[model samples]
Target: MKNVVIAQSGGPTSVINNSLRGAIETFLSSGKIGKIYGARMGILGVLNEELVDITAQDPKQIKLLERTPSAGVIGSCRYKIKSQEDLERIVEVFKAHNVGYFLYCGGEDSMDTANKVSLLARERGLEVICVGIPKTIDNDLGGKLQEDGTFAICDHDPGYGSVARNTAINVLEANEENKASYTSDPVLVIGVMGRKMGFITASARLADPRREMPLLIILPEALSQDDYKSNLEYITEKVNEVLKAHKRCIIVIGEGVNVGDLGILKDSFGHAQFSAAEKSAEQVLANYLNGLDRKDEKGRARSRLVVSGIARYEKPGTRQRREIAYVSEVDLREAYEVGAYAAKLALNGETGYMATIRRIPGEKYQVEYSKIPLNVVANSAREFPKKWISENKVDVTDDFVKWAMPLIGGPLPEFANFKEIMAPKLCRDYIPAGLREQGA
Candidate 1:
């Protein structure tokens, strides 16, 4: 029987585990696989010999894995493998257990790791089929967009729809809150996730398709580290313009904006991670406004910044993404179908290919899950398109809205605002040797 090995990595999204569930269910229904194993905490688990056999898990429990939030189940790690020893270790593990089919679910870095492992396994005389399932709320993989030349493989990734919905809706809700507090608060600044991409911030446009609201959306891609002063001055002018027309305004900042200038922490991939960034853009923007001395219509000095941060990861620790009830049924189906297609690639003896979803050539919204060489994907990094942005950089063009509107699928998934839900957290708590020594 062909043994299946699957691993998840990178940031958690709402429907990430649904992809895992799809992989597990695909194997469960197949007679060709003997055991389905999950590498604990992504590829790091394999290097550490930590593998969980989901094949033996209860069918009901396996089903719940789809709706479960976070990498809390198999666990996840930020540990990266770059050395020769790392590659050798992965090859040995695959050979040891006959892990012929490997499915990797994560963002770019995870895809790179899976691609490398497939090659290493082949060198070790093991025929391993490796396929990648694309995911990320950032929606920054290589998907097709119009002639802007900057596009990702996904039209709107699984997690992006929910986040876009949340961002747009929150902008509207924050409008209500700010509207009520306008006497004390004139501006509302919100921080959103999207390390180097503008997709998340652009989603804010969905809230105001008519452009009647006095809103400004900021994306990291639209500014540079050195543009901090100019950016602030620019925003200040816009705020004044909005205030002239309306009593209150909403501003959205991408979390990674000016992170380099603010001294932020970076992951092993040299990508700026939100937790590592010393000060968030919200904090910086708020501080900028607070530090400045502005004047009202009567030239009265008013210096204050009303800002708050909304984390994308709240529980799986990625908020609202996997709030199962909040998950877009369309997104869940696409994510699951992506996993199932990855399984088919592995089963068909395809090696070193990333299973990517792409829209068909017609004018319709049809998509087909297919395979692309990981080498091509690993080499290219898709950024936010320039044409998608207006000259003012305050809003995304209508072309972007048309490209993104379909993925949100009309509206967000339904959920009770205060309803409490809990998944079974596994009980085997053990600290790492280094942490244990430090009494962590």
Candidate 2:
């Protein structure tokens, strides 16, 4: 029997701990593994010799991990291995700990890290099995587009379902709040977390499939921030159109929607660090709209029909990704299955592969666990398909709703509504002072 080590990397998710738990319990039951160790703080833990003996932890607490959200237990990190010295040190530490099997849980960058480590172990003649576990709310890991417009590599990353459900529920609640408060704040701009991809932002549409709400969704894939002036003008026009028809509007924007040079930071992988950025997409759009002079197509000042108040913005930040209350039962189950599958692969001597999920072809929701080459997943990225974007580029098509609706699982939270009949007027109608002054 050989010893095993497990570690997590990159951002935490509502179901990430469940995956860890799955891997731990599976390995323990296999009886082909020795001491089970957890690498604290991801690869950083390996470098610093900070290994936690999972075999010594309380079994009750281990079981609780099924409901525990985030990666606070063994921890996770964004540190990237860049040197031969670091690689050598990792192998040395692993040899000292008698670690023969390694399971890494995370997204694209983590897969790349796992692949490199597995290659290095082979080069150094170390007997080890390395398996990658897929996890990300962005759903950008890797995949091929199916004929039915679904992704094939992994139907969807594990954390995406929960976050999609979160966004849907949030939009439902925001609609209620917007309806009540739009008299004062006519526009509510909600900023969601999804850098470079629109999965998180597009999920808001799932809240209202009938297109009943006066909602506008802005995705980074649909708009180009390089031409800030034109982009701003286009979005302003869309919002005004919605306002003219419905008195109030709700805008959902992705955090990565190129709001033009907000002093963006970069991580080791050179990906934009939106969290560290000074300004968010929603804040920028709100400020721009609030400061506008209400000009017409001729660039002349005009009195708009429903520009009652300035737009208010909210950036939920990490709360969108880590909130346990919003987790989907489907996502939690898949996360655990993938983790266990990775353990099974390691025990069976599989190496340089990632545990992937594929949605079965059927009317009912179903999925099966499989494996894919880590190199392929590490080098590829799945983008929000352009065909899914609406003709106006401000919304997603019904096809998108069909693809994501099943993942969220169960009935969405419902809101209350009363008869919209207006009360009879007691006095004669008169022109408002603001409209009169504008000479309308």
Candidate 3:
């Protein structure tokens, strides 16, 4: 009988803890395994010998983990095992604690870490079964586009659906707020989490599938900071057009959108630590647009739009990924099943594999638990399909909506609109002061 050690890495999600519960429960139910231990802060916890005996925890608390959000229970880390000394230290600690099964829950970089540990353990003569459990809101970990346009390997990540639900719901609610408040702030800019992938930002379309809302989505995949001036001008024009047509506009921008010269910090994995940046994409965009002259394409200045109330922005930051209230039932279930399946694989002496979810063909929203080689997933990334991106480059097509709709699970909240016809104005026609100044 071999003891199991599980650790979570990278950013936490609404359903990430549920995956932890799944693995823990599965291991406990299997009489073949010994005591189960959780690393306090990912690989750092193991390196520092900071192992918590999860088997000693109350069963009630374990069950409660199914609803718990984030990695608060056991905690998580961004620490990367790079040096040979760090690798050796991990093997030493596992051997000291008699840990023969290692389960890692995280994204692509975490998968690379697991693969290294598995290989290093064998080199050190330690018989360990290492498995990776997918958990990322970015949805950049694995999967390739098939000939039929469906994704192969892993369909979507566990945290992705929950965050997608969060993004969709946020947009839905923001539309209502913008509709009422557009007289003051005509543009609402929302910054979503997705380092280089647009999946999170694109999920905003799930809110208005009919394309009825006056919205613009800016993705890192669609624009780059290299041509900062050009991109900024193009985006400004789009926002102006929306405001003119609809009187209000909601813009969902990915955190990774190149806004130029943001002092960025890098994590151990060498990825840009967007959260630690001095300025966010939303702030930069809002500021830039606010300074722009409200002029028509013919170079005629307009006075109705003022710089003081041009745009208001919000960076949901971590809330986009960890908000339990927005968690999707589909995401929660898949997260748990992936973890449970990983544990089962480890118990069956399977090593160097990651538990994956494959969307069933002709699915009425069905998926099957499966496994893939850790090497295949390690250090690999999946891009948001170019075909799914609309030709205009500011929106996702119906194809993307079809692919993501099922993952969000239940029916969305319905918004109310009163189609009331207003009575004729009692006073003579009058022009607003600002518009009159512009000679309208």
lDDT of the candidates, in the order given:
0.74, 0.89, 0.88
> Model 3 over residues 130-223: C-alpha lDDT tens digits?
9999989999988777765467768899999999999999999999999898877888999998988999999999999999999999889897
lDDT of 1 by residue, 1-440 (tens): 76888998877777788888887887778778888899998888899989999988888987887677666888766667789898998888887887889998887777888888888877777888888888778887774565532244655566777677767777777766776676556677788888778898898898777786778888887876676778777776776677667756778888867633657677777777775555677766765565434666787535533332221211111463445555556677788888888888888888898888776655566778878888777635577888888788777888787777666655633322444578777988777785555344
Among all windows of 10 consecutive residues in model 2, the one with the lowest summed lDDT is: 300-309
Worst 10 residues of 1 by lDDT: 308-317
| Candidate 2 lDDT tens digits, 178-214 | 9999867999999998999999999999999999999
**Candidate number with the higher lDDT (2 or 3):** 2
Pairs in clash, predicted candidate 3? none
Clashes of 3: 0
177: Cα error in model 1, Å: 1.2
| Deviation of model 1 at 170, angstroms | 1.7
TM-score of 2: 0.94
Candidate 1, residue 172: lDDT: 73
